[model samples]
Target: MLAGIKSAFNNNYVSAEDQGARPLIANRTAAKGWETFDVVTNADGTISFLSAANRKYVTADLNDHTKLIARAATIQAWEKFRRIDRGNGKFALQAVANDLFVCADMNLGGVLYANRPAASGWEEFTITALSSPNPGTPDSQPSTGFVVTEQQFNQIFPSRNRFYTYAGLVAATAAYPAFAKTGGHAVERQEAAAFLANIHHETGGLYHIVEANKANYNHYFDYNSKYKVVPGKQYYGRGPLQISWNYNYGAAGEALGLPLLSNPDLVAQDPAVAMKTALWFWNTQTGAGTMTCHQAMVQSKGFGETIRTINGALECNRGGGGAVPNRVEQYKKICAMLGVDPGGHLSC
Candidate 1:
């Protein structure tokens, strides 16, 4: 049920895909460090987990498999992903006719699917040998397992590792100009990793539900409440990534090739538009070329600095609503994820 770490083996069964796994389960006789919890691709284009030290595969029965269940519910295109028990005590992944493998799951009616393209980070798994965990009665879409042990899950799943990551401000910024110019300042790899980090924190490893407790803080702000739409007031939040505020909404709409809306509610209804709006805000409004949200943090020592700057310019804070404090908290949390001292450090 759980796992322990073990020493590296002299076995030559290791393949290119079997490399770089952190030991999740601890082994009593094994050393403290060795390659253990590994990720690899299957022939069917789905990801496979490997446990190097124990030489056992992680397989789940169809009833116990959460990932496949979720995929089956949403994407009809996944009718083919079957879980087959390899006779030698392993499982093989296979797809159905006219169906393909998607690397990501859906959130809010949107699914981030991937294909076998090098640019999209797709890799092909080479099966030197055949093995099976379940025999004759394999499900059309069978359950799969991590080749990892319990120790590996404890060690690797808790932190920002390759096992989990997602798109957020970082992805929006890097992929588009609006976010990159203002708040989305991370370079290619950094931005990619950060986006995944933010999404990981938001959705818990990219496959879980967007927790209600963590939703708004990670999502775009204004769309959470629909009853607050005032005639001339700023509608700040909306969408999966939660792009907020009148200025951001308007600007993001233009960048994403959607119609401009001063209201945040519009973002939530159109899922693709919501993503576009987020990208718009991150790329143009928050980076170096424009308002520079991160730079403002360097100057004023917190997110409060950017809020105050926006308030001063927009006159929206005329009522003294106290958005600065909230901004400071969000900014601090993001900084902490990067392992930076929010109060002590001025330069990022």
Candidate 2:
């Protein structure tokens, strides 16, 4: 479903009028700056159309039945759209508030109106792919100050280089820098290094994918558990960062477009999926706190805070201790290798 949506809308520029008092309309031939929109999926399962012109959200007004406009960057319920596929190349967007589909009045020069009695041909839309705005060309999006060159990546994991592989890391790094540098726990070099270093420590420099104790794999099964183990599947640690347990695998798989709940081995077998799982864990998991590992690193909260954010209960004495110092030391070493000063706050 996500692949379908992303393939259809991810990079296209949306140009439609809002059903507001102003009746916002885009000139198809000579569209204004506010006319273009970029599609982004929210963590909460809603779809957002971010205006390419000013980077705001295409929002619906709850109070005014006919109002829809590009407004806030922060999403609310009104900003969400339920995309209804019409089985053909067409689709309709049903407003969450009134359950009425948006109607694009082609006769009125592409003006938008909603609160219709039912979804009709006028409410249906056929999306067309368009070129994304050149990323590097935008002055507003400055280069993230840190990057891990292939040369540097090779140097970081010398012994387990074969397992992690320079090519695999390069592919992962290239695929994510834009996403990592964009929002939430946006990546700076320091933050990137911290994440990589922790995964290195977790995987013993990337040699280990699945955890040990192959004999007791079935112990992961428990009826009341959140992520119920598959009847014959084992959910141990896998991937670069060792995503252990059933729940972690299920959540990560859902987010990464994989079915790891039944096929947990995918994390250990597919290099691209493995790399993505590590990133998904880092960017989303709050561990023992409100802050994600990425957020903790970039917000100047220090590497130690990230430790607490990731495994404070185990490594910071919340559940157990003995491992905090080693984590701190490893973080510092990686920061040095990356050529960035490990900023303050290095202990849990």
Task: Note each model's CA RMSD in angstroms.
Answer: 19.0, 18.5
Full-model lDDT for every candidate:
0.33, 0.62
Question: Candidate 2, residues 43-113: lDDT per residue as tens digits?
Answer: 44556565544434556666665656665534557666788888767777777656777765556654555
For all predicted structures, in order, the TM-scores are 0.31, 0.53
Please identify model 1 stretches exceeding 4 Å from their true place. 1-236, 240-249, 262-266, 286-290, 294-304, 309-333, 339-348
Sliding window of 10 residues with minimal summed lDDT for model 2? 1-10
Clashing pairs in 2: 313-319
Instruction: Give model 2's clash tally.
Output: 1
At residue 58, give the lDDT of candidate 2. 59
